[model samples]
Target: MGCALSGPGVTPEPTFSKEKRGLDLSEETECAETPEPLHLSEPQKALIRESWKILHKDIARVGVIVFVRLFETHPECKDVFFQFRDIDDLQQLKMSKELQAHSLRVMSFIEKSVARLDQVEKLEHLAFELGRSHFRYKAPPKYYEYIGAQFIQAVQPILKEHWTPEVEKAWESLFKYLTATMRRGFYTEEKTAGSGGKSPCSRKAGAGSTPNKI
Candidate 1:
């Protein structure tokens, strides 16, 4: 299974009660009229692929750091996971079996996507499907930006001698594609669901098979 970021504050407010949801773009969410497809050059792919090789090897330890930083950035996200929900201790949440499993799951998704960077369509499809799944979580485009940021912050130290601007840009490109495609899938599903306001968690599928919180 891959990662879902456990959308900490992602309950769509209008439809649900006060306790639900989140977005990445922060302010406005009017989907772009002509959302550009995020693309990567051969060199860019090479940079990302090689760089990821260094990071994935230590994903168990590094993945925890990523989630820790992620929750610290959005403490509200702690409530999204049943494991961490209502817990007062930050370290406890960080070390819980749930966080460990979930964070690693999320990393696996990252790993799968990174491995396919060379296959642009394949990569896009991965994002497309990921977006479709995330639509259920009510996660907004901006969260992609957040996830990408934490991923780098967590992996930079592990990469030590290798992290660079170019590598960061490559990861950014991948996140852009993921954000755009996910929004596309989410909105499309939302439109099709109409005012019926179906909860994404109602159906079980893919990596995030548990609840649709994140």
Candidate 2:
């Protein structure tokens, strides 16, 4: 997996309370418009897995495309990355080693998430922790949804005929589930840190914040 600069404070391993473990996929769907629980049937899972196999071959390019598109559509997000915040040139960013490494970290996280679909609890835990880490990184949950949408747009051309509505729905459901869990984690950390919420840890020269892995 790729690595990025972590936020200053130390984050503990996530714990699953009885109530938290019992939460169904839909329980975290923070969308007011659609409160439906997340439902990914066997066929949908299979569709995502199969499509991922084809996309994985171009994971690097896709990762770059996803983030580039994200920055293009949501320029404010660039502010969250210390290493990238000052760089106004989008084309130069595509070639940065930091961007490449960060992209790999994100793609690796997605790969792991896809592998864990059969294990719901594990998948939830993974995403939850990622959110907690993001809190330290100062990357809010609002930007999480954009990554998924950009990923879909980046891969649709590669998936071509295989990119059916069902496939799209499956990916969307998975992202929604992940982002919802992530949001829960973000709030949990926020509450734990209390008001002011600045990290107790010291900062490093190039330590930039990102949403990919802890």
Candidate 3:
């Protein structure tokens, strides 16, 4: 459930002005206003749950394969991880216990997320908190998209027979939902940190608003 990979060190930038803040959050605000932003249906939920049951058995392998593929396809990503940064050989890196452990942790988070499919609010909260934590860890949301795609690739063969267009769509929808909320949380933290520990947007929204909850 923790940060799946290390992020580059971040030095906070200057806070936005009133007009600038509006500009900064305009897209995020638009996304937030959209109803059923995830587009996940009950049938999609069922497909995700069923596929997960099969995928979970090879969780460890899937986890390792995911990151390895990530490093292969996006070699720059490896530089973010302090532990793996120096390791040039993908084959050698594969055997490292550190990679295995962290990869497993990421998968475990996926496990919990699958279990929370029926509780939409809880699921969103979980992803949001993780995103906030990533902000602290200096993990940019840009890399989040890569992980979901890598995960899908890693699990396809494991569920070779069970893998279907429907299942793929379901998982893709889930990742989309998670990444969207996570992006919101990341921006929320960034705004708060940049503005001397208070988010200007949330202040305008008042107490107990969606921004505050995120």
Candidate 4:
């Protein structure tokens, strides 16, 4: 899990409702019915399990690629990310030799996390929290769509040969699960706010008045 950063004083208005945001799967009709429990053949199960390992490694690799591309293609977005300077510091942290060691640690964590198929529930919870963190950063909801597209684009070339229909299906399923979880978290925050609850770092009006980095 990423460390939580203290937010800036500027509280950007929510760009969109949870329902309108990217990856929303709140509509009951939108969720693919939990498919009949797959009774996978031994070989098929092995293939899927192996494929998941590959996916884990590939996602991390692609994350680096996407991060680089984002910095290059939309420096403005980078600026927004760094408005509070924590994002900038984290980027610097990732560039250090220590990052290679940290990557290994994170990879180990990923392996353990994925060891059980039943752990998907926990994974969903993590994703939801990550989404809330993104909101705390004042990232526009559309940024998720942009990042997702960029991730797919980055991986397509490398995955072309191994990207079977099943692989696509698996990723789609994983993303849908994540999206639904995020939507739930977003709405929960909104409800809490409406009820006069405060976030840990609620911003004062006119805080974060710094001009956007763009």
Query: How do all models score by TM-score?
Result: 0.73, 0.74, 0.78, 0.50
Per-residue CA lDDT of candidate 3, range 1-214, in tens?
Answer: 1332212222222343323212221223211322124456788888899999898889999999999998898776676677877898999989989899989988998999899877666777777778778767655666777898888878888999999988887887778667766765777776678779876545221122222111
Candidate 2 structure quality by residue, lDDT tens digits, 22-95: 32122221211221134688888899999999999999999999999989998877777778777889999998
Report the number of the highest-lDDT candidate. 2
In model 3, pairs of residues that clash are none
Summarize candidate 1's per-residue lDDT along 1-214 as a digit string, tens digits: 1223323222222332233334222323322223335457778888888987887788878878888887787775565565566666778877689888988888898898877655555655567567766656655444555777788777787888898888877787667556665655555455446547563433222222122111
RMSD of 4: 13.6
Model 2, which residues run further than 4 Å from truth? 1-37, 195-214
Lowest-lDDT window of 10 residues in candidate 2?
1-10
Lowest lDDT block of 10, candidate 4: 1-10
**Which ranges of candidate 4 are over 4 A from the true structure?**
1-48, 55-60, 71-76, 83-116, 198-214
- If both were scored by lDDT, which would come out higher, candidate 1 or candidate 4? 1
Q: After superposition, how far is residue 179 of candidate 3 from its true place, in Å?
A: 1.0
Better of 2 and 4 by TM-score: 2
Off by over 4 Å in 1: 1-35, 195-214
Task: Arrange candidates by lDDT, descending.
Answer: 2, 3, 1, 4
